[model samples]
Target: MTFQNEEMRYEQLFRVTAKFHSTMDIDAVLEEVIHTLQDVYPSFSYTLFLAHDNTNHNVIPIKEIQHNVNGENPAVMQAFVTGFVQIEDRIAEKQSVLYAPLKGRQGIYGVLQINAHNAIIFPKSEIQFIELLANTAGNAFENAQLYQQSKQLIADLQLINDTSHRLNSNLRLTETMTFMSSQIKNSFGAMEVGFFMYSKDSLEVLLGSTPFFENGEGEEFVTFSLRKILKEKEPLFISDLHSDATFQNAIYRSMMSVPMVQGNEIIGVAIVLHESPYYFSFDKFKLLQSLIHHSSLAISNSILREELEKLVITDYLTKLYSRNHLEDMVQLSMETDAYGTFILVDIDDFKGINDTYGHQVGDEAIVQIANLIKDNIRDDDIGARWGGEELAIYLPRVDMQTGYAIAERLVERVATYSNPKITISCGIATWNKENKETFQSLFHRADNALYRAKQSGKNQVIASENRVC
Candidate 1:
């Protein structure tokens, strides 16, 4: 080669290296490498095999090295593994193939193959130039990869921050899980997301899980995940569920199962699934672990808050609503309902039972009556422990006749179902929009009717005199 020609080649290499250093876009860097080589050596063909499959330059001959079939290119593998250049002289084909490792300071990123048609051997100077170009491309690729990864890390942190803030805003458990499911579906492209809470020794599918789990279609996955999580107490990242012997026919190929941990215990498991194999990357699995770790405490707090609220309005012994809660329901019903009925029930001869059998037996009698009231009433009906030996039921939108019938049924059920058999007296009252009755007036009428029933006979149902029955 002439001195002028070598100097010109050096100038081109210098300019391309400067261009590579200026831009952090990986595809642009890769394209520039191929274009520079084509300009310098038009007779030779070039192909770049990258370790990561993120580039989208259709015009450039770029392939992922990881996807290469075994035994296809032993020289390319050796160059990547040894971080050195390799040469293969195809004497029969009268061609020389060169493999140059894209070696960065951190690691090798890819292999660049140069095919010299009709050349038996590549000169040392030509190999040196190609090696320099490959090294420059490798450094640029690493820098671009690191830049993209940093941006992704920032986005992931923002997502976790937003989710943690929203979850801690005292949202209900159902709402929190729903928000999380939506976030996972949008960010990770998950097909199904499920939150399964541990209750006692069993797993209970929570409200925000997809219908696929709630309807029993995903029971096998749930059981498998539960068993693994319970034993390992660690997150699972599965590339192909079908690869496992137990899940050979599984429809979902990719899965991530993270334990919702609080302290040392795993309270629940969060599962995300996809139908395509290897859909979720390891980075995504790590991000999910972080998300669930931060959200678990908030979930636990929400659950505890709901349970505490329930306890506030419940009677301890009978497990019925307290008198205050009954009053609130009655007040709300009177405002919204067209008409409603209130029944006040008292255990017959409760003082006699206490005197004869002890207060424990009397308390048991009150609980028995409370259970009977619950069994006979609709779910919307409010059953409360009014006081010692007295209980109440408020049936919203129910008329006088229906209320009387319910009371009569309770009277009979208590007599028959109560152990150490007992009877109950009931007084029923009805109110409608036309009557303009306040909650206080409604309760007074029910109390007055109860007095009348006690006077008439115990274990009988009576209604306010103004009402028919």
Candidate 2:
């Protein structure tokens, strides 16, 4: 309280204020606050209660403000809430506690507590000095936070830019989604990522989704997300899935689901998850929205492209491969495979069915036979509409006996399963690596054998003789 002591305090305050302004680092500012307080008030114990728990200072006595906790110190909370200093005197303990708000122009960030041991009161001048130091620290903290936020914003923009560029590079749907999944996992530290595409009013998990979704463990999450995204048509940021009544036993605590929207429609959803509660910040949720928005158009384009490609090679009525596609498959099989079977199937008396029941019935009979062929063939086999009322099946790596048995099975299935009851004549032709026959030759032989089956019987299978020209 002497004139000399007041001048010295003023000088120290000026020096610390300059130091606080010299760096934008939050840790440095916090350390300076603690050092200055310790140097000036060595007799008093000090603690800094920050609003957020992100800062790290091992030596400084720092704790998070428990705003909602019961039985917390009223003086500290009051100083933080009111942005004013609070003083309490404990007469029985012969001590006084002072709580100073770390107030900047924007708001109060924390409370600075000074416990004066063995004292019932603090001098007015000392309280004023502590208040000044607390105010300086608050301003420095605000500036450091702004600096860090601006840097993060720049990085987020760069991530969105990179993702958008890659997605627009004409990558297929699977490739684009896989790249996006990797980017989100690495950037957000997510434990799992999934991409779901809307198909025929339902959501189908894309290939790039993590194995957690494919293995059926993520069905609940998918169903929940699908319902919410479809109903709300907005992104979801769940801090803790376990807190929800429906997901009481959820393993993932944090979740973010952003709908991939194009124009007015939601094409799909991008979901990110983490095991820790409140793992994703609000800023990250916003960034995810931006990333999905930029990538949605590219994804929509890829889906449309794939659909168009499918239509090009697919038969419209039967959903089988077109004759051109069948030829390509047979040629590729003959070049690479050791042996293969080609079965040319013909509906017996197709003209009679058209005359009796109409052309629509004939088409139905053809579709029934195509479905039977699809059910009986392996996934690698190619089933095609060879022509009107005629279907073809190319089974790669199949030998002569297996091919004849498959043909016989198809002949029986068509006779039994076809509506309006129609039968098919099937001709089987086998080719191996030794027979250097063209696709045309293979087709001619199958067609000849099919003619023989039709002449021999209306509902039977015939295998072509192995005669290489």
Candidate 3:
């Protein structure tokens, strides 16, 4: 037939091919394929059968195809109208059923069978037409498969990228690793997740339920593990803690461990747990590696911060409590109503001594005073440099009378032991019940009394009460 006689052939263009290519629209492709067959050869009846067998990779079936050209023919609707099959040998011998292997040169995709009413649609030319349809249909099916593969790959890539972003945004080690665990579980349906760190002393990373030390059956083991991370430097993991039949009782299946390591030492571990197989893929492993590396950096910073925090609260000069530390303690005392005696001691005529013998002697004087008083005070007492020559002490559980007695002893000790003519005067105050006083009031009253002692005789203990000469 020439183009003039076959002018309707233009209508057979593959619109169903377009539907197959659309992402997440697999149903659209199937419906369109059956609909297309109905449009062509309106003589018999139709139904589309897709292969569910793995013989030819389940090549979709285009079958039982019918068309109503005259409208008097009721549509033939039977199950076995058409089918596609995978036969071992390729042959062409047929009088009852027509079979065309859905094939390309590479391999047989499947088969397509065309059935019709008796011999009304089974002529030699109609057989030729069915073969032609199968050939073109092969290309369409391949396109659909390719579309599905591409869509899945794109989704996986997007998920991996999103996991990366979420892990990077936070530097908190625990939170970051936990986030990775959740992502892996959601993406791959893994069960259970945890992080573990290795130790050089302990050597191996214990997984699942066996406690390495005593008191570790429940809370103690978790505490011991995390405490080890805090106390030492090491990295480790125990993947498959529940697998291998050894840890099945613990309910652990599979696991992955990433260590937060710094240089030669390991800080901690990031762990993921599962109770099933295939918990992780190559993508999951790579994600864990990246996550662990980031974890190491963040954990290192946390360690450094803790050290710096300690230093910030300590005085470098006298190795005593810094002003900031003292302030915090006072605030805590204020809030808790912790009863304590606050003694403020000042070197009498310390500036005159500095002017006479120089700052070196002044420094020596302060040191001598600190040693003498600290040695005499209770071990639980808090001694701090209230500023330059002034020193303060917090004696917990001591009342004003007891503080006054201790202050007298300090004044006696400092005055008698000094090489120079310099002497120290002290003042004492306790937590005030009437005022519901904070450390601020106690400190202020002590300061006032110390000044009075200095003014009265410059070498005696003058507490906040009648002067004890």
Candidate 4:
């Protein structure tokens, strides 16, 4: 080693060092190391290897790193071995080389190999210079890794915050699950992911995986195993299923199943998959856990909100759709396909029944009437108590004729079964292709028809058009 040797490369080394320190992109820094060293010592081909963050389940391979050649050239790579050994591998065949173990003050990150032309003499100062440069490279690599980890931490925190915000704003379980599933899939880079919930009896599984199923994977073994897990009440992970005797035909190979829990009860499980043989790592596991935990909370809150909404929209005494619920459903349904029949009914002399039998028997009659209408109508038909004595029904895809027929049946049933032999008048109005029929107009028309039925005689059904007739 001599001043001439150290000074030979100082000019290019200065530029490369400055670029390395300037860059926060770790990948660029590693490439800069290779490119700069190649300029000074082009005698033998070279390679740079770097890694950090060995304390956790993460691979902190040096960023921005490159070898003059690819991984194929074992002979050239073999030449980079010398007496200095924290690790050993020949760098190139014909040349004596130096392998410097890069480390911060704490511990080793990785080894860097610099191969010169042949057996060349090195003085103390040049050796000292290589040590100093290696120290810098090691430190830069560590700092870059820590910075990246910090960035990822920020992203996770933001995700939690964003999801919490959505819990208040979205109010729909499907939408929230979709957002959450995307976060998990993108965070872990899985080929596929699913969430499945089971009934308390543990016989049925509900697919709430990705909001909606865009693929058939959820309908397959993913659903079956989720049911099994809920029955057993546990968390399970499967590395590869290809070799397994039980589930060989269901999935191709690698998969993971994690229980999604809220409190002591296991509500569901999160299933993740990858095509490769070895994809699950500690980082992957940790990320999956965090994602599932947040998802479970989101899912639970959404469900509770839904139940509250249901409670708000239902009449406790009669179990019919309450006025508030009817309005919401009517508006939403109107916004889409406004084509339907509207039926309005008024209990004939209902004050007489309430005054005679007391409110309890009146309440029971309302419940029975509601039961009759619900039992006869399609699930698409929405039946609601518009107010104390008026009931409204919106029948999707049913015209005025069918609506009047149904109304006649309901009126007759009430007339025959009333405790005091009460009667009712009903009206039906339906939407045609006519451009003039709004939801309000339909309701008004139906109301007028009911008035007609009341005037004609009680216990009769009339269509809006029939009112004028």
The digit string of per-residue lDDT tens for model 1 on 333-415 reads: 88888999999999888889999999998988888887877788889999999999999999999998888888888888888
Tens digits of per-residue lDDT for model 4, 228-318 = 6767765555667666676667444566677878788777777777767556765667666776776677787777888788788887766
In order of appearance, the predictions have TM-scores of 0.89, 0.87, 0.43, 0.65
* Candidate 1: segments with Cα more than 4 A from true spot: 1-23, 53-62, 66-71, 465-469
For model 3, residues 261-366, the per-residue Cα lDDT tens digits are 7796665565555655444655566656665575466545644665577678766656567766776776676666656677788898888999999999898888
- Per-model lDDT: 0.87, 0.87, 0.57, 0.66
What is the C-alpha lDDT profile of model 2 across 1-469, one tens digit per residue? 1222777777878998999889998888888888887777667788888998654678888888889635378778888888989999898998989999988888889988888888888889888888898998899989988898899999999999999999989999899888988999999999999888885567788888899986778988988997998888778999999889988888899999999887787778888999999999999999999998999899889989999999999999999999999999998887788889999999999999999999998888888888998999999999999999999999999998888888888888877877899888887798888978888888888989888888876698877783211
Index of the highest-TM-score prediction:
1
* Local distance difference test, candidate 4: 0.66
RMSD for each of the candidates: 3.1, 3.5, 14.0, 7.8
Looking at model 1, residue 232 earns an lDDT score of 81
- After superposing candidate 3, which stretches have Cα over 4 Å from the reference? 1-16, 25-86, 89-193, 196-245, 263-265, 314-323, 332-440, 444-469
Cα lDDT for residue 444, candidate 3 = 78
TM-score of 2: 0.87
Which candidate model has the greater lDDT, 3 or 4? 4
Model 4 clash count equals 18
